[model samples]
Target: MVSSSSAPGSALPGSSSPIAGPAPLSLCAREPRVPADRLVAEMVPPPRFDSVRFGTYLPDPNQPSQSEAVGVLEGFAAGLDGAPASGARRGFLGFGRSKAPKAPAGPRGVYLDGGYGVGKTHLLASLWHATPADPSRKAFGTFVELTNLVGALGFQQTVQTLSGHRLLCIDEFELDDPGDTVLVSTLLRRLVEAGVALAATSNTLPGKLGEGRFASADFLREIQGLSAHFRAVRIDGEDYRHRGLPEAPAPYSDEQVTRVAETAEGASLDSFPDLLDHLARVHPSRYGALTDGLTAVCLTGVRAVPDQSTALRLVVLADRLYDREIPVLASGLPFDRLFGEEMLRGGYRKKYFRAISRLTALARDAGRLVDA
Candidate 1:
C-alpha cells in the first residue's frame, strides 16, 4: 500500500504536499477518481506466489524454456536486492549477438517479454514482493495505467512525481498509438535519468513495438534506444491462464436465461456497447453509475468488441463484477469470439484474455444461481 506521504504527485487525490516544480497547468482539472484500494489490489502479487521464493520457480516438463527464464528473473530480482549487476543484456531472441557495448553507470532494471499468460506479470510481481518494503519507494502497475496518469497529470510532473520511487514495475509495456510511443519514450528516458529502476513485462519485444499500424523508423529507433537501458529476458511457454479451468459452457440457453430472469428480482439488462460507454464516461473508476443499484447484470449484443479501447474497458468491468461477486449473463457471442483477430495480436490481447477467463468463471457462477 502507498503511504500517504509518498503519494506520486500532488495531482493524486488526497495528496497534500506540493511537488517542487512549475505550478500545474490545470490546477482545478481532475481525473476520474479510481479507488486507490482497487489499484493496489490489482498490483498485489497473486496468492500462489505469496510464499514462493524467487529460487523456487522450478522448471516444468511442459515448458522446457521456462527454467532458463526463471533463473534470469531470479538474478534480476537479486540484483534489485543489492546483488552484483549483470550488465545490460538483450532478451533471448535465438540469435547469436556480437560482443555487447559496455553499460553506463546507473541503477539497473529488467524487461521480461513473453507470450500472453506466460508468467511475465507473475515474475514482475514477485520482484515487487521481494523488494524490501519502504513507504512510497516503489510504483507498480500496468503501462497503460501509468500512461493514463501521465495524460491526466502532465508528463514532466508525472516524471517528477515518479522519480522518487526506487523501483517501477510496469506490466503490458506496449506501444499502439504513435503518440503513446513517443510519450513512453520520453517517460523512460526521464525515469532512467532520475536513477529509478524499472521492471516491466510485455507481450511485445521492444523492437517489435507498433509492428503493424504505426511502425516507423523513428518510433522503432526510440524503442531500441530505451531497450538499451535494461536487460530484456524472454519467458517462452504456453498460456497458463486456462490450463486447469473447466471448459467454458456454451452460451446460456434460453431456458437458463429465463431461469435467471425469474430468479433475479431486479436484474438489469444492458448492451455491451452501453456498458463500454458508461465505463468510458466514468473511468478510471472501472464500474460506473449504471452498476449502482444493480444486483446482477445481463449483457446482450455481446458480439466481438472491435475497438481496442472498449475491449480494455470491458476487462476492468469484468474484474469489478467478479470482485463484487455480481453474476453476469452474456449473450450474442461465444466467450472465445468476444474480441476480433486484430485485438488478439497486440498489447490488448492479455487484458482481453484475462477478461474472458474471469467472465467465464463468473458466467458459471451465474449459471449456478439460475439453477438454485
Candidate 2:
C-alpha cells in the first residue's frame, strides 16, 4: 500500500510545479508473462486479505446468518485434521472404478452463498488462514485463477497438484461456461476422492450457479455433481461498502485526471477503450500482475463496455485494483454507468455488480486526491 505524503495534490520537494513530476505509466503498455511455477506459488489470498481472520470479521448484529457462517466455517476449519479418505478405488484420470465402493456420507465442504461486498471473500480467505494444515497444504484463489492453472498445466497435472492440498478455498466460484463447468466438476471429483476438503464463496447458491448465464438443462449432470460436493451456507446482508455512506464522488474531468496521473507517485494513466483492448491480449491470471506497484489508476474517456467479454475482463481488473486498495480516478461516465441494463440483468450480473461496488469504493478514496 502507498502511504500518503504531503496530502493529495501537494508538490514534491524538488518538483517546481504541482503536476511537474514524471508521467505515470500506462497500463495498456504492460504485458506480463507469468510462468506456471509462479501461478502455483501465488495461489494464496491477495494482499488486501492476507491478514484477515475469523475474529476480524464483524458480523452485523442484525444478521444472524453472518455470525452463524463464521462459527460454522471456524468449526469446519478445525475439523480438517485426520479427515478420512474416500473408500472408492482411484482409477485413470482420478475417477473411481465401476466396482469401487461409495465414499463416506457427510458434507465434504462448506459453501458461502451471498451477494457482493458482504465480506464473502474476506470470510473465504479467513478460512484459508484458519485451516490447521501448513500453507503449502492449503490453496486460495478466484475461480478464474483456478481454471487458468488448469489451462497452464494439463488437467491431470492440475488434479495431481491440488489433490495433495488438505484444503482448497475458491473465492467468487463461477459457472459461466459449459466447458469450465465440466472441467472443474471432474477435477473436484478427483480431489474429493483423494481426501481433499473444499470451500467456496459466491453470489449464487450452488444449485443455481448457471441459471441465468447458460442453458443449465444441458449441463445438469455436471452442475449437480458440482453442487453435491458442498453444503451451501447462506449469508444475508447489504453491501458493507456503501450501506450508510454517501454516494461515490462523480467522475473527474479529463484534465484533472491527467494532472493527478502525472503528479501522483507510482500511478498509471490509460484511455478506457485502449485498456479494454489491451486486456483482451493479456490473460486474466496476469491481471493481478498488471496492477502491481500501482498506487492509483486513472482512466480517461470512460464509457460503457461494448460486450460481455470486455465487461468480464474489466471486472477482473477492478478486482485486482480493489485487492490492492488502489484509488481510482477516472473521466467520463461513472462506474455505475460502465455496465448497461441488459448486461446487469444477465447471468454474470453478480460479477458486474461486484465490480461496480469495488470501483465506486476506490473512486470514493480518490475523491480525497481531488479535494486536496
Candidate 3:
C-alpha cells in the first residue's frame, strides 16, 4: 500500500530527487531482481492442448474486430496530419499517416495507465515489436521492473545505447524514487525537445508514480503537460496478462463436472463468495467476472479471455461436463456466446480473423476444439 498523503518535496523509501535542481544517478534505489528460474518455468506457460474444440475462428486482419486499434491509429494519424480529433479510447493505436505530416504531433508526458491486470505490458511490447524498424529512426523499450530505475543495472549503459534512437518505448515506467523521477524527467524532457516520439507503460501515471515525493498538483501539472507531447491511448478490457499463452484447458477433476445433475440442482451452501475470493487470489487480474453458477455449480477453474486486435480468444477446458449448454445457463453475463468478433459488425470484421492463426499452436498444446 502507498501513502497517498505526504508532505511537499519528500521521497518514499529513502529516495529523493532534487525537484528543481541537479539530478544525480549515484546511489540509485535498490530494487530486488526477479528470480530467473520463475520466469523460465512459470511466467512462460507450456503449449496449448490439441484435443478440444474452441468456438468461432478469431477475426483476421482483413476484417475489423471489436477492438478499437484501427480507430486509435486513425485518430493519431489525424493528430499528426492535423485535425481536431476526439477523447481518449482504449485498445487502439494512432490512425493514418498525415499527408501534411506535422512534426508527429502527439501529447507529451502522457503516461498510459490502467489497473494492474490490464494489457499494459502486452500493448507496450506489441508496440515495440511492431514499430517500424529504421536505424535512422530509433525506437527503444525498457521494462523498469521496479518502482524506480535507481537500482536497475545498465541504466546509463542503456541510456547510451538508446540515446541516439529517435523513437523510444519504455515499458513499466513507475517512479517510486524521487531521484529516479528527476532522471526520468530529464530524459523525457530531452526526448521531447529533440522531437523524439516516445511511448511508455506504467502502473502509475508519471505524477502518481512518485506520489509520496511529488506534490499532486504540481506533479499533475508537469506530467499532464508531458502527456500533451504524446498521444495518450487507454487500453481497456480484462488484463492482457491473463489473456494469452500457449496452453490447453485440461479438466482438473472429471468427477466435479460429471456430478452435475441432468436437471438443475439446489445450492449446497453459499460457495459463490468463496469461489470469487479464490479467483481474486489465484488469477491476479481485474479482467475476470463471475457468471451465474446455476445456483449450485462451482467453477473449479477459470479461463481469461485475452483481448487482441485480431480476436478475443477465451480459455476453457476439455471436459464436456463443464459446458453449461442450457438456455437458462446463458441468462447471466455474456461469455458462452461471446465469440470475439461476433458482436462487431463492419467492413474491418473480416481481417480480424488472422489472430486465430497464432492461436493454432496454443490450442494444439493446451486445448481441444470446443464441442460443436
Candidate 4:
C-alpha cells in the first residue's frame, strides 16, 4: 500500500482565476496533486478540551493531515502483510558494486528528497520495522521528525535502547527553510564517522532543503557527504497515496501473499525452508534483496547473518528474533534499508506485537507451538 499523500508538481488544480502578475514562488504556490480538502482538514481546529478522545484525538499541527497520515500508516500496516508494488524501486547511489554501476559504500547523508507524499515516511517506517535484526547493531537517532530536533539529546535517548544503533531514519525531512543548517550539518558528519547509517525523507531536494539560507552551501555539502554514505532509492513515478487503501493490492497472486503470510504467521522460532525456496523462485529480479528467506542479501555480497521470516512478517520477525536473542541477517528481505539507531524503532512498533500475538494465537489454535 503506497502512501496517498503525493501532490502533482507539474500542474495546479482548483485554479479559478489566472495570475495577475509574475508566477508565484514554489512555496506559496498550490500543489497540483494534493486535494483541496486535505489542506483544509490539516488546518482544521485542534481537538477541544471537551472532546471524548482528547489525549489521543489531537493531531500534530505540523504533520500531514489525518487522511495523509492514514495513507502512510495503512500502507505501512499492509507492508506488515505483503510485498510492495513494482514501481517502488530503491535507487541506491552507493549500494551496488562498481561493476553494478551503483555506489558500493553509498552516498553520504542518504537523502530521500522528493515531492510531497509518495511514501517517504512509509519507506522510513518499513526500514525501521523490517530491516535490522540485531539489538546490538548501531543505527542513528530519529529526532522528532516533525521538529527535526535530532541533536545531542536525540542520540543520548537512542543510546539507552541498545548499543551501536547506527541507522537513523527521519520522516518528513523539511529543512529547506533554514535554522536547521548548523545543527544538521554539525551532527551529520559525526554520525557518519561513528559508522551510523543515515536515511531521511524530505519534500525538498538537498539543494532546496537549505535554499536561500546562509548555511545553504554547508547543508548541500552535508547532503552530498551523506549521499556518499548510502545509495538513494527514489520512488520517482506516481504518487502512491491511493496504493494501500482498503481494496487489497492485486498485483501479486494470493498464493504469494498466502505463502508470505504463512511465514508471518508461522512458528515464532521456525523459518520455513519452503519460504526460502519460494523466494528463490519468486523474488523479483529487482527486489531479490528484499528477503532471502531468512537472510538479508547485501549489495556488496556481505553475508551478515540470517534472522527469521524474511518473505514474511518483518515487524513480527524482528521482535521474534529479538525475543529469541538472534541477530538480523542482512542477506535478504523485502527492502534494502538502514540498520542503525533509528531503524530499531519505528511507527510499526505496535504491529510487531499484534502480528506476533495474532500468529501466536493462530499457532496455538492449530496446536503446533506452545502458548506459554
**Candidate 3 or 1, higher lDDT:** 1
Model 1 weakest 10-residue run by lDDT: 22-31
Per-model TM values vs. the true structure: 0.65, 0.84, 0.36, 0.31
How many angstroms is residue 187 displaced in model 1 relative to the true structure, after the best TM-score fit? 1.3
Candidate 4, residue 329: Cα displacement in angstroms equals 44
Model 2 over residues 1-372: C-alpha lDDT tens digits? 122332345444345566544556777767777889889999999889999999999898998989999998887777665444333333312223333234333565777776677788899999999887779888998888999999999899998898888788887756556677677878877887776788876444333534322222323344466565566777778889987898867899999998898777877888999899989998888988888778889999999999999999999999989988999999999999999998877777878888999999999999877777
RMSD, model 1, all Cα superposed?
12.0
Clashes of each: 1, 0, 64, 59
Per-residue lDDT tens digits for candidate 3, residues 1-372, read 112212223343245542442221111111123332222122110111111111111212432321454345334323432311212121112323324455343352334444433434344434433434443344433333211222333345434434444356665443433565566756665445444456665433332423211222333343443644544555444323235653323332323332331222421111222333333332111111121222323222333223332122122111111222211111112232223444223222221221222222232322211221
Pairs clashing within candidate 1? 91-232
RMSD per model, one decimal: 12.0, 6.7, 19.8, 24.7
Q: 1-372, model 4: which lDDT tens digit per residue?
A: 111111222222235544442221111121123322232222111111112221232233443443343344333223222221111223322322223222223243444433333434444544444433342342322222212223323644323322233345554343433556445544555545443455665433233322211222332454554544443443432223323333211122324322332233211111333333333433121121122122111111212124333423333233233222222211122122212223223332223223333233222232211111
Ordered by lDDT, highest first, the candidates read 2, 1, 3, 4
Better of 1 and 3 by TM-score: 1
How much does candidate 3 score in TM-score? 0.36
CA deviation > 4 Å runs, candidate 4: 1-109, 135-163, 205-227, 242-372
Which run of 10 residues does model 4 get worst, by summed lDDT? 295-304
